[model samples]
Target: MNSLKRIMVGLDLSEMDDTLIRYTAFLCSISEIESVYFIHAEKSLDIPQEVLESMPTGMPADEKLRTSLIEKVEHYFGPDSRTQVEVLVVEGSPLKELLNLSKVNHIDLVVVGRKFHMRGSGLLAQKILRNGRVSVLFVPENEEPKLDHIVVSVDFSDYSLMALERMLTSALTKPNVRITCLHAYQVPSGYITLGMNYEDFDKRMQGFAHNKFAQVLERFPSLDGRATLHLVKQENEDDMGELLVVEAKRLKADLLVIGAKGLSAAALFVLGSVTEKMLRYNDDIPMIVYRKENEEIGFLDALLGND
Candidate 1:
């Protein structure tokens, strides 16, 4: 899983910025954060000719935007910050700028707001989660920044395993934080070929799931006391995401985590179907699309030129 050291928080200068800033500060206080960047992205920083004609001083638009955001960060990022903080206002698509900045800065994690009643796009969030090599955390407007209980979506895939193991580390999990490994399983429709009835097939699926869960526990014997597995049967054909979200809410999870699957070499991003569903259905519970960073390097990924 991608580490959480240098974090980049996306700010849009909206009400959500308040929550995002405080939440990031809360994270910085808890984790071993080396640096944090509060960035606001715009399509263009050029002031209109009519607007510029009335201005007395000729400060650049990006500089003005940066100054405004820095003031806000200072006022709300708390008084005892120990980590390095930088404010940036860039010109580009908000999503693309965030992706490019992540690569350019060697950023480990990207935190952004997950609006509920406010306007938001699951598709855009999906793209950011899939395109960026770094992990992405979605913070709801009203969700508290505390990391008390983390509910991890586990399907026994490598990605799922990576997410769970990373969540147990000191970066995100405190000594007293509770951990839940949530698994949702469903019986295949082809059970009739095996001469088994629906009820028996269901029981078989449950048993197989438990067996897999046991093997997983063997790998992480330390999880004996640290984590608990909550299993649910997926009833509908396309209900894995909704089921996970409902269970997470019922368990009063503060944070939800799932491993990310990026673009494959031969084709486009293998945006896991269930993950895409969860992003669309989830309205609360801060979620982390955690994945190990890609090894590929390019022009933007070569160096952190910003000092």
Candidate 2:
């Protein structure tokens, strides 16, 4: 909603298993989107005599596949969304091209499908969090794409506060809309040199977390009666992503909003391991990743989730 004039979406040809793209188009159609960019990034292959010698079979060039994928997106979204559509087919990494196109096109939001769950803490998610320049939404595979109950995960950072405010302004249209402010906690994994009691440490930590939650509530006037707060004590049993997904599912939340750091050097080397894993989750729960900036953070909650 945030006066979004341009929107960009990254698509993979093989993962056309659902109506995510169409759903996105529909959402855009209802908004004030001036244009939409559908991008497909493909891998290239150069046939070498030595490599040909090793090949058991020959395959077609990757560009053809890329074009075909772009065509399919055009076919699906073109007739329905009716908004201006620009298609780009590029070689090399999807993430890189996606980011480049965002800059070149002056896009405000980049919508992508998350095929799997991200693993271990990585810098890629961090960088995306910090430098992506634009807001990014990672849509999950489950939970029918609708806007309804939305849970905003908060760490009480400046960026996260912006995210919460944006969600409140953009995504909720109906009077019955509900927003839950979730803060997660977990015990650290390490050795203590001091002889301090473990129970005392936990008690103090819990108290600090509660105080932080209260402070978050007091900081935002937009959240007054529109949002309720919930504190989640992450058992040593679950990772951050899992804990988030579980709570969203339990609430039958239509959308889950979380702030991401984007990607780091190490995360890039892994080639979509972190974000892709989060995408691969078979659930229909859709999510949007937002950059921590004043301009990018408003009305994002609606676009981040379905109502």
Candidate 3:
């Protein structure tokens, strides 16, 4: 949690934009976040020459518009505030500017609003999740920022384990917060062809799942009493993401935390399939997608051995 010192919040000036800002503010109030930046990326405004000529003599229309947007964002925070806030307006592609800003400022988290029904915002969110290196938290429209119930998806990979550790650390700071670590798995189709009884096969699979859960707990003894484990079985060997969404809904989880990628090297550029599907299928719960920081390798180590 100490790594999350600076936070960047994306603002589209839509009605839902305030929700993102308020939610980030709430997080700052609870966590050790030092500063928050509210940034708006202004895409093409397409103004004709005639309209420019009729504008005020001193300030241009675009400049005035940017100023107004900044003012509106500042107004949201008002005079009384516990955390330092800054507003910025940049002219370029939203995703591009946001990613650049995150890299330049070393942002720990990027907060943005997601509208399930809107195509433009949804695509923008997906792009951010795929391309941005910083951790992201997508808040749904009108959803309150609460940490009462949290669910972290685990698959025993380094990425998922990092995500679970981060979530557990954050939850430990809050009062009355409950955490559930969920693992969704499927049995291989070839097992059915081995002439095994269906009931016995199911029982064996369940036992295997329980054993793996125990191993996970043994690895992180800090989570022994602080978290609960939930195992989900998928008969089809697919739709792991869909099952996660269903479980989250059934548990009435307030937040869902997951890793940005999994154990595959193919996930270097884009998100893992399960993470992508969860983003597309669930529109009600807010999700936090975390990426573990890469460890720096020395020059000699890089040349002589795999680091």
Range of the 10 consecutive residues with the lowest summed lDDT in candidate 2 = 298-307
Q: Please, what are the lDDT tens digits per residue for candidate 2 over residues 272-296?
A: 4423344344256767666544344
Using lDDT as the measure, the top candidate is 1
Model 1 per-residue lDDT tens digits across residues 84-194? 899998887777788888889988788888877665543455557655677888888776778889899999988898888777663778767888899898888899999
Q: Which lDDT value does model 3 have at 240?
A: 74
lDDT of 3 by residue, 1-307 (tens): 4667888988876777767877876787677777788887867656465644634447765665556556656665666766678778777888788878988888878888878654345567667766555688888988787767888888777888888777656522364677788878666666769888777777787788778778878987766777787878886855777889889888898889998663234453345567888887788898988876642223422232221
Rank ordering of all candidates by lDDT, starting from the highest: 1, 3, 2
How many collisions between residues are there in candidate 3?
0
Candidate 1 residues lying further than 4 Å off, grouped into runs, are 47-58, 119-124, 265-272, 295-307
TM-scores, all models, native as reference? 0.85, 0.64, 0.82
The number of clashing residue pairs in model 1 is 1
